[model samples]
Target: MQPISPIGVVRGGRRQVHEDGWGSVVSRIDLDPAVFDVSATSGLDAYSHIEVVFVFHLATRTCTGTQHPRGNTDWPLSGILAQRAPNRPNHLGVSVCGLAAVDGLTLTVHGLDAIDGSPVLDVKPYLPEFAPRGEVRGPAYAGELMRDYF
Candidate 1:
């Protein structure tokens, strides 16, 4: 597989790995000037939201293959792939955040879960056409696990 590199870096948000209270975090994603031209974000403002794909650089890798969500035994045991924990195989994260503005190579967003200094892998406009087509369902525990995850 080809190696991946960051297109940008997150500027502000929770610096720690605490899972809750990410709803109001505002962040700036500054694209690497050497890697991309300012025009890279030219028409991105047309979309109300964007999908930010980033790396969980701070999560310590763990060997446990399965665990209760958030370490809560009340939730059923789930495989690492079945959960959204950052310590999974790839340590990658994706979040859909409100697009506040696009200025040159910088993008201002709301509710981005990535922390300051996190490497941003990619950014894509949120297109409703790509939404799930059929009924979406998951275990009840998953809902509680994301109750405050934004």
Candidate 2:
């Protein structure tokens, strides 16, 4: 399969997670004006959140086997798919962020997990119907690992 090009680049924030958590993080998704028209996001503001599909441009390798989550030995060993690790076969990430505002070719978002200079593959409005239908379940370690992760 062929690879896809990014539609935009992230700006302003670094890859590091904040000590205060994701609440204070903010970043801008600057789409290529040539590829995306300003009108493309005209109705986007109607939604409170947007889903951002992006690439882990900084990821070095794909982890295919089982490993501890976040290198924490306390967490049970699991395959890459079992956890939301960035080191995957495909270095892609999807984050649902609060849509702060949309300008001509830039989208101001809150709580976007990506770092500055990350490549954005696509953007979609978040609809309630698209969320999971039932209760979400996971290992107890998953909760502990994400306790500080935004």
Candidate 3:
């Protein structure tokens, strides 16, 4: 398989990684002009939200075992895949955030958790049809961990 390439770069958000308090952060994703034209985002403004697929470019670890979420001992240990920790293999992160505006090839978004200068792999409109079916359940700790994550 060919290696993945970033279609855009994040800007004007948190400069460093933080576990929480990302609710109001506004960011801009500038699509590479060499690869994308303004028409690429022509119809994207219709969506109220979007799902951003980005690389955790600063993640230094590739943990593959069970660990407490956010190093909080109060939470139960879970496999790397069970949590959204950045230390896992592949360093991929996905967030469904509010779409603020789409200007040409530049996108302004709210609540994106990725840091400034992060590489964005893809952006997709958030569709309710793609949501989980039936009941959805998770450990109580998951809610607590995401209380301020937006």
Best by TM-score: 3
How are the candidates ranked when ordered by TM-score, highest leading?
Answer: 3, 1, 2
Candidate with more favorable, higher TM-score: 1 or 2: 1
lDDT comparing candidate 1 with the true structure: 0.90
* Residue-by-residue lDDT tens digits, candidate 2, 21-98: 765688899999878878999889899999999988888878999999877798889999887778898989988999
Ranking of models by lDDT: 3, 1, 2
Q: lDDT of each prediction vs. the true structure?
A: 0.90, 0.86, 0.92
Report the error of model 3 at residue 17, Å: 0.8
What are the clashing pairs of model 3? none
Q: Using alpha carbons, what is the TM-score of model 2?
A: 0.92
TM-score of each: 0.95, 0.92, 0.97
Worst 10 residues of 2 by lDDT: 15-24
- Candidate 3 lDDT over residue span 1-150, tens digit each: 987899999998899999888989999999998878778888899999999999899999888999998889999999999999999899999999999999888999999999999999999999999999999999888888888887
Candidate 1 lDDT over residue span 1-150, tens digit each: 988999999998778878888889998999999889888888899999999999999888764599777888898999988888888878999999999999999999999999999999999999999999999999988788888877
The better-scoring model by TM-score among 2 and 3 is 3
Error (Å) of candidate 1 at residue 23 is 1.2
